[model samples]
Target: MTLKIPLENSSFNLDVSGIAGFFGGEESFAAMSSVHLVRGRRWLGWYNSPGSYYVAKKYGVLAKSRVWDGLYPGVNVDPTTMLELDGKVGPRYVAAHSGTRMEKTGHLAYLLASHYSDLEVDQVIPGPSAKSEAHITIASLEEFKEFEGYPKLPADHLSPFDPIATVPIAFSVGASVMCAIFGDWYCFAMIILGVVCNGVSCFVIGSGVLKIKQPNPSPHSPPGDGVLFNAPGSRVILLKGSEKIISSITRGRFFLEYKSQSQYHDIGYSSVALTMQFLLQLFIVPQGQLFGQIMFLSSLGVSWIFNAYLASVDREDLQKRILMRVLLQKPTFRTVALPKWTSLVVFAAVYLQAKPEGTRGLLEQLIPNDTAVWRLVKSAVVEAVERNKDPSEVVAERNLDHLDNQERGLLEDMMKQASIGYNAGNDFKL
Candidate 1:
């Protein structure tokens, strides 16, 4: 009597639009499977052949249709001989001879048949074998299905601020501000105390936030009982356990140390800003002079703005590093692009702030003379500057290249410095 097994129907249907884009186009999508609709292509071709349908119905739990293409080329092996062949022939040879391409049904049948026939089937599966190496058995099909989804993505969370550490730091900042306003010698003492507390808090918070701990594997069990075969040649066995643990731990340690140092620099810069503000208010602003007061306030505002800019730049640098790491690990669906509107706004601001020669040079390098956006920004800035200046102070057209050589040389030096900085090592110093 031929034994028959029922096919498990899928609870979820494939997202056709998403799948179509993923494979390149509708034609590529249609080429995926033999089944085609009048309007759209079928996701899986299992229904095209009775044998394929039967195998998919019976062993769908072993793999999903989307992932079947990857598995189909390597499904002919008897599980019992997989390890032996793998050790002698090497992985490339074993993978090459595993099966014929596009044989979805045959692959499913091979997987199901191998699982039932071989007692040590778990040891010889083509995919990940770390848990199997550790003698970890799936308690149910549900547990195995959990591991079969799309690749696990990294978490999006990035900030490492700890509220507990932040509270004390906030208190220190407040105390330092109060002391500075009163012009007390105790302000120096408070500043010193705040710096020390800032360092300790940053280290403690960063370590907690980025901690990495690996789970200990189960102790070895007797062979042929609960144990899977101990194949030292398996990639997972050699690299997944202790090696992964060590690497993660090292990475976490380095991140924490780096973040702590950045925080220290941030605190030191804030201290400098506070000192400048205090000195300006206490000694530079004369009691009766409006100009002295305006100058003092301007200096204080500029110092604070510079400090804030440095902190923001550091954060952006860190975010870029994180994004690079993530992209290295996963396939990206689209290239990142800067919005045109943002570019325009930033260009307008830069042009308004820059010296005319410097602005003109930047425009020459950044945009063609005929570009509409550049023209708009340049005309607006030039009109505003001319409107504010006295007619007598307005420079003649001949001085349009004012400080031309010096500004161009300065701009080139700045560009060179930026290029060097970007190409330098990832280590960011304040």
Candidate 2:
């Protein structure tokens, strides 16, 4: 967590232990972290995580290095290290850091192994001698490259380019340039298409991510029966189609409904800005329509700035932002929503201007509320805590089916209070 970047004589230690400590779970996993030092001021970091057992079994990793082996004892991890380096001692064992992507990636894997392998060795091996050895594995560049060449995907790897982050920005910028060359219609069309595409993508992806799959009926399988997963070293496993499985895919999907709703808000604001540009062209005599277009485009830049801030924020700060947006808190929500609502006025004006009906009310028609997604996640978590059951087991056991009518009503009331659209009055504390 303490990254000591090389500096002439003394290395500068950037303390990121606080950030590292934020990521807590019961079991260990394969993690690769990279920190990029930019201009001695800005530090950019990326973290890639994969399930421990998946990587271990795929690559023949030692069981002593995998803590999850307790659940799947049948998995075979070779006792011998893949390859050993000349200097493997602790005090003098410094990882080789390099500018090359392959070296940087290899070093990250090495660090994770060095840190977590000891814990696994102690937990899985159950002997003093296993702990004394205290070994780790580092994949060679050739072995790493082999992963990229694999025929099947879902491989344990990371790439320099992230399409999910890049594609939308590229589309926005490209459309903006086109709009500047053409006319207001291009800007109008971009926002309209973006709203439609983004909304559909959110719904389809959210449905898949949040859906809870129940276990098949079996006399032997008791309540909360399913496949075991991370943390607490419990035998209870997650059901095949459980919402918890979304964690394995991506943590980014957790609050996707909120993110999509925020995107709708963004589109609404953009629509209003476009409407103003149109109004300047139509109504005001000797109007500075060119200035209006520039102003409209500037809004996109400002939105990107807001996005950058969101990206840099830690979990607690993010939660606060979500609460502010969802609860419609003070000037924050007022400031954002007012302009978006102005889009309705713009739509009225656009109708007189002979423009096609805009996508103003499309969002409400598409996503009335994400109440169902919230209900599923809340019910599973509460059941797990109340019954001292694994969340996956709760999902497999038919998602709170055992709850009596009275208990269900209580849970429903709690959910109403906790739901996103719920008004948080003086008494309610986030």
Q: How well does each candidate superpose onto the true structure, as a TM-score?
A: 0.18, 0.19
Clashes of each: 1, 3
Candidate 2 per-residue C-alpha lDDT over 1-430 given as tens digits, one digit per residue, 9 for 90 to 100: 5333123133333222122111221111111101110111111111111121232222222222233234234544221111111112211111111101111112112222233232322112122122322111111111011122222221122123333334334545554544444444533343333323322322222221111111233333222111111111111111112122211111111121223232233323322332333333233312223332333344334333433443343422322232222211211101001011112222111211211111112212211334554345345434443444443455556766766787677555434322211111111211
The digit string of per-residue lDDT tens for model 1 on 1-430 reads: 5322111133332221111111222221122211110111121111111011122211222222334324233343321122111112111101011111111112111222233222333322111222222111111111011111112212343333222323333444454444444443333342333244323322222221221122232234111101011222211100111222212211211111224242233323322333333333333223213322222233223323322332233332333333234322211111111112223222222323334443343333333445433354444433333344311122222243544675546433333322222222112111
Show the lowest summed lDDT stretch of 10 residues, model 2. 32-41
Which candidate gets the maximum TM-score versus the true structure? 2
Q: How close is candidate 1 to the true structure, as a TM-score?
A: 0.18
Q: Which portions of model 1 miss their true places by more than 4 Å? A: 1-280, 303-317, 326-430
